[model samples]
Target chain A: MISSDVIRGYNDTFLLSLLTKGDSYGYDLSRQIRELTDDAYIIKETTMYSAFARLKKNGYITSYPGTVTQGKKRTYYSITENGRNYLKEKRQEWRITKEVVDKLVGGDNK
Target chain B: MNTIREYIEQMFKGVPVTEETVQLKADILGNLEDKYTALKESGASEHEAIVTVIAEFGDIDELLEEFGVSRVNEQVTKNYETMSESDLRQYIQAKGKMGWNIGLGVLACLTGVAGLLLFLAFQSVLSGALYIGLLFLVGFSVIGIGLFIIEGMKAGELERFSSPYIILPGDKEQFISEQKDYKRSFIFSIVAGVSLCIMSITPILVGALTAVLPILVGVAFSLLLIGVGIIFFTYSGNIWSAYESIKHNGKYVEVIEKETVKHKRNKKVDYVIDEIYWPIIVVIYFVFSFTQGTWAWSWIIFILAGALESTIKSLAGSWDKD
Candidate 1:
């Protein structure tokens, strides 16, 4: 199971990676993260919005206004090429981290 | 499923859900909904599944921190650190307004003096210049008092009390105490000195020395009095923030323990007290001295009135509990 800290540290990467596939809004993005993690990781709306702001600020994502169901105009965010590259780098970092952690923790489990 | 939906709805409920926040909220909700559907399929009750999903979302503040959005109240946070804390606090207490009003008072004084001198130059046996001097003094006095009233109103207004986070920015209790003492001492010192110069100078001179002594004494007195006024007021500026903090209940002024350099977020600091505080006194003094009265006593009285005014003001300022 992923710790809360781990999810927080990686929220930006996960959101950007998800958007790189297609544009999405807040609720949908949080739902997607749960699906991908098999419910192991979930991002709150507040967390997701904050990550979106950061990603947008860093030029990794762009947001535009669009209408969703219930006549609500929602902001939709899409990943930029820069965001894709950022996700790639973060993914590599996560891989290295997982490898190091597994070696350390699984050593005794086995 | 129920718990997740409830949490999702709650999160979005009161928030503006502006375009930027909405997009992120929607994405998170979608991810949650998917999990809820899967959990329901696995035979978890709707409410249980939703609760489980909501519980996993984690702390919101940490999430916002990554985006640098957690420091949302940047203006309040920056107020203390952006300027010299002492300077900013003084600035808010309408010190600049004070300085501005003092300048006006000085101008009014000069104007009264000019009016009086003109009256003397133009006067004849038929019409004396005394009335002109009195008129000018009275006119300028009105203007000076008007400025003081306006400054007080500005200081007391609700809008001026506003800071980003809390009341006047600093240790508010200490601020109030120091301000009280400062105002008290300042007013007392000026009034006492002026009264001494006016009421006691003759007795002092008669009792002490007689040659060129009175003139020397007058020079010494002026220098000493002006010097003391400047020193006390300058020190008072340093504690002005504390005064404001105390007045504000220490809530509005956000005391920033950490330093930040962004000045745009910092509120008012380092106001010009001289502008507001000195003008009326100066106007009254110069008007009385340079206008209708040429006697040495006139100068003494002018200076004495100024001293008395300062004392009264200080007393009034200290009346507040803060």
Candidate 2:
């Protein structure tokens, strides 16, 4: 389980990383996150879209008209080079943070 | 499962939940259907399988929060969109500047009125310049009205309810920050007003000694400028009072994902000439004109008719639906 404050920042970064691979719709993205977390995490559609809004505003990613198999066209977002760089930076930062916290929490066990 | 769906819908009941949220719900249901399919393959009864899936799904509130939606689903009453952060800053700056202009203009109007009265009292010495002095009075009135009207028009264009720059929308902390900035500027204005009042003492006393009563004369002239400033600042009904007042008026326009604001009160452009201002201007013109015993009724009748026109306009606007 993740603390709510930390979770939001993580979710934003994770979404950016996923988009760096290719375009995906909201539902598919949420399911991918679930599978990645081994069912430990589930993101709501609202959070995903809100992050999408923030990312779009910051110029990290851009959206375009794309059609899915089902209904009307959906606004599919692709990661710009800027988004890819941001994801790389965030990944390094999160790794360092997780490593430091894990040491402190596991000091006695170690 | 139906109970869970009902619960989720009930939770989102009054919020302006966008179409995206509805589609998201359908996705969640699809996931639930998948879970139900897996449970049925294990040979459990259909109702029990549904219950198991519902139990596994946990709370939707946490899911909603993950998407940055407000959990405490109160209807957002003031939906003022279009007033972006930069626009808001511009509005505040414009209002402060308008206040300064009104204050200074009022001081000028007072000087003009006092100069006319004093010049008239010593009419024997400056008889040649009296017409020039009358010209100043008319000129001041025209300038005052012109500035007031322009400011009112600016105020009208300001977006009423939504502020775009505030990233974490509806945060009380941001609200407090805005209020503090407003209060600080408002106090600064009051201090400036005191200094202005002091500046008017010399001309006011000099005019009274020459014959026109000082306090009554001073107050009348002062209010004209103040009224003009208020109109200038509150011109578009975009001031702090406007924000509060419009809430009492309810959003006048329907809006969607992109924010839009509706004017609650009358949108009539009343030129910022209040009752107090007209009476004062008329009396000053009347005093100086009657002192000269020229045809003064024209000024008086004109002021009276203008006042009647504004009053009728205001009353007629009330006929709009509640």
Per TM-score, the best of the predicted structures is: 2
Please give, for residues B171-272, the per-residue lDDT of candidate 2 as tens digits: 223434665566655555545544444444544455456655554444344434433443333323234543342233322123322232222224432323
Question: Individual DockQ of the candidates?
Answer: 0.27, 0.07
- Give the candidate number with the greatest DockQ: 1
lDDT of 1: 0.57
Candidate 2: C-alpha lDDT? 0.55
The local distance difference test score of each candidate is 0.57, 0.55
| Tens digit per residue, CA lDDT, model 1, B139-228 | 876776676577667655533334322322234455566667678665665565455435534533542465544443443344333433
List the TM values for chain B, per candidate: 0.35, 0.42
